[model samples]
Target chain A: MSRVSTLLARETALAWGKGGGPMVAVGFYAGVATLLPLAVGSEPERLAAIAPGAAWVALALAALLSLDRLFERDYEDGSLDLLTLSPVPLEIICAIKCLAQWLATGLPLALAAPVAAIALGASPQLSGLVVACALLGGLAFSFMGGIGAALSLGARRGGLLTAVIVLPLFVPPVIFGGGALASLEAGLPWSAGFALLGAYAAAAVALGPLAMAAACRNALS
Target chain B: MIPEVSIQSLALSRGGRQLFSRLILKLSPGEAIALIGRNGAGKTSLLRAIAGLINPDEGEIAFGGVEPAEAREAIHLLGHLDGLKSSRTARDELAFWTGFGGGAPAAVEAAAARLELIPLLDLEVRRLSAGQRRRLALARLLAAPRPLWLLDEPLSPLDAEWRGRFGEIMGEHLATGGMILAAVHDPLPLATRTVEVGR
Candidate 1:
């Protein structure tokens, strides 16, 4: 197999193999979705009004679930040191790691988002758009969360630090995706928010690795 | 192909404390050097600098005509950390480095066998003894052919038998004209000249 394929395969196994893979994140997503209704009281009108936005926000937070360990694990175990020696550049390595994070963790949360939103009384018709937004938003989450993970390497309270750094970055995607959903609910033009979300995700994919690679190198040095 | 290593007037400091300065060393194929120093000394840092992980405060580390960064592919660095994931099986860890380092996958079995790790291949890394883990880590040297080996206390965890085995391995590596720069407070099983750092 090619080096990238090997890395991808290894990462896939690692993503699912370590911790509980998507189960933990999806479980967290489910837990938050299940609790929101109880806490807000099961008034269908109120729940329905807030369901999509709540679900969108929950998905963004769930993406943070595994971000702390993205590169930290390898860095701790010395895998990152060896990885730097590979013919592949560290930037590509960071990208592959995030890709695996998306496949194993974010994708499941994306699937769960629509279900959670609908469970909270979001219109079933909106489920399709919910899934679409979650998919794009989740991609942004994986890549952007990676930057936080890399920067917080070798840090005290790394997990908390990652969340603090990444939460602000998550704001744009959450707003864009949530705005798209809210606009659709209100029968307004939702394409603008959706387009912004896509552009944001594309930029995150293109640029997140560079920042991650630099942070990792700094941590290593 | 063997690469010549040249270090000219290298200086480094840690935490604003000077570790060493104006140090010089050179190595050709089939040569080995043991870097000896106290705990606070920069032996490991020197190795890392040579590996291109650190920018020297002053001076240059060259791997012949290759860029120091690019020369890492031809190098194997076994630091104090083995890089093995405890949750993964020994075989899986070996497979990862093998594939990542562009080694022939077919060599995995041979590497395992050479390290006497055949029995523990299927076991998770956490289950292995420290010496066993060390041997498994060392197996990468066989799986991939890198001309320069930078080992940080490579034999510390091993019993006499395994140390002798590793000595033979190092001897074999040198016989093939590879170079070794190891950091250790203990004597290496094979003959090597010494470089004192931090003094």
Candidate 2:
């Protein structure tokens, strides 16, 4: 097999392993979605109004839960040293890691978002849009989160630090994604928000690895 | 053909403290260098610098016949950390690393057999003893066969028998024109040269 395919396979195994890989993130997302309704009382009107935004927020937080361990475990075990020395450049390594993270956590979360949205009384008609938004929004979250994970490599309180660094960067995606959904619900053209979200995700895919690779090199050094 | 590593006036520092400076060493094929030093003497730092894991504060290390960018592939560094994922079986770990290093599947089998790791191949790394883990880590050397080996405290956790086995492996490697630079407090009879730091 090709080196990249091998790497992707290994990452998929790690992310799908018994260690609560995608399950934990998706569970967290569902938990957050389920609790919001109970905490605010089962007012369908209110829940329907807030469901899309709440689901987006929940997905963002769920992605955050797994981002800290993205590179930190490899760094701790000295695998990062060997990886840095590999024939692949550090940027490509970062990209591969983020890609794996997206495949494992983001993809599952995206697939599950519609269920959560419908449970929270979101328009079932918007379910398709919810899935589409989740996929794009999740991609943005994973790549942006990669920057945070890489920067916090050797820092104390790394998980908390990563959330702080990444949450701000997530604002644009959240707004664009949520705006797209809210506009769709209002019977308006939502293409503008969807286009903006796609652009944001594309930019993250292109540039997140550069920041991650630099952070990784800094942490190693 | 064998590779030679030349270090000219290499220097390293950690946390604003200069660990070593103006050090020079060279190793041709079929030679082993034992780096002897105290705990804070930067033995691992030197090895890491040579492995391209860290930048030297000063000086250059050149691997003859290899581009500077590609030199790291020629150096096999086994640090104090075994670098194995506890969740992975010994077989999977070896296969992943060897394949990553561009070695074939046959190399993994040969390495496992050489290290007497056949019995433990299917076991998770978490189930292995320290000595077993060390041997598994050492197996990477055979699997990839890099010319320069940087081993940090390679003998730790090994019993007398395994230590003898490891020595034999090192001897065989040198006989085939491979080089080693190992950091240790105690001496190894197999080393062709010794460099002490933190004087």
Candidate 3:
């Protein structure tokens, strides 16, 4: 487990440093969030209302943007085939890749939510909840998106294909994430939403890799 | 002793496309086999199936004397990409792989030198020529201590010199009771058994 974690960390660091995709996605998230205020103009109530939705959307988009390259590059280059042949099961490899992807893209998006929230005139308390929801919710997005990314390898227009395949699946996270934030704002218990989000993440963590391994097998075949 | 790896009546299909059907093969320690086929002939698929990358639809593969996941610790597969991330410097790639491979750094460095990658260690993999990348990939294989090597198109872009060097290394590996299954289009300069696919 430690070995897998270390490998995941190392791979994530490498991907974050070398690939412009993650950075570009984060940049776009910040850029879009920053522009929202200008477009809306001093409407604090309006900003607060739309802030959670925008943040959720941005987080999802950021995650989706990085999904296509998750395994496609390795698959095309034959590295994924080698990974399957590793002494490690493809499940472990997929888990490691997901960990890396979440850390590289999802974690950063979570951390960046505060900035996005502030840009949309969210109060400090609401902003904090937004970040929390994003931190937990974004992991589920990464894991689920990984499945789409892995399955779409070798498909024509893989980037577009990834988005098309993954977007419908992403609705769960988006809904629960926004609901969690709204519940927090309304002084309602947000734990249920958080719990639901956590459950999704857990399920994705447990089953996503196996699905990905099957997808890889299909792609190779 | 039982062979290091064996497959019986292996059949594989993906999305209803039958990539391979009823394939049978085996490899004992100290044996080397070459897989030959035309493009789309399933040479890579065969290597992948043997390495457990793809599950066979109608057969079983046993490694050492057990299942693939059970015998994974002793198996290594090298595909066309060499699995090296082009963005990473060769040294960084080696360091990262060594961290997981559990092999000695000295041995890896020595293999790098022998492969003439010493000077290019700091260069990113993307900067290396195709032949260089192939050698670097082979160097990685040398660094690993696994007993079974499943290679796909192992000699795609090598010149005559590197090809000879690869042959020598493979010969040495076989001499040491290591098993090798390589997919190649041309003849390799070693005592080898050939398996033709898509017949």
| Model 2 chain A poorest 10 in a row by lDDT | A10-19
Q: Per-residue lDDT of A65-150 in model 2, one digit per residue for the tens?
A: 99999999899998899888888888988888888888999999999999999999899898998999989998899899999999
Model 3 ranges off by over 4 Å: A38-42, B6-26, B55-64
* CA lDDT of each prediction against the hidden true structure: 0.91, 0.90, 0.79
Candidate 3 local Cα displacement, residue B131, angstroms = 1.1
User: What lDDT tens digits, residue by residue, belong to model 3 across residues B1-199?
Assistant: 2357878898776667776787888888898988888888788777777766666778888875675565766777787667788888988777666556656767768878878899999999999999998888888777766788888778879998888889999888888888988888988668469988866
Stretches off by above 4 angstroms in model 2 are none
lDDT by residue (A1-221, candidate 3, tens digit) is 24465478676876687468467778989877877778877688888888888878878887887788888888877777666655566778887888888887788788888788767766678877777788778788878888999889999999999999899989998898888887887889998988888888888888888998888777876
Clash totals in order: 0, 0, 1
Candidate 2 DockQ, CA atoms: 0.76
Q: Measured by C-alpha RMSD in angstroms, how accurate is candidate 3?
A: 2.9
- Which candidate ranks first by DockQ, i.e. highest? 1
Model 3's DockQ score: 0.53
Over the stretch B49-76, how does candidate 1's per-residue lDDT look in tens digits? Answer: 8887777899888888987667888999
Reference-based lDDT, residue A204, model 2 = 95
- Chain A TM-scores, per candidate, are 0.98, 0.98, 0.92
User: Candidate 2: deviation at residue A68, Å?
Assistant: 0.7
DockQ of each: 0.77, 0.76, 0.53
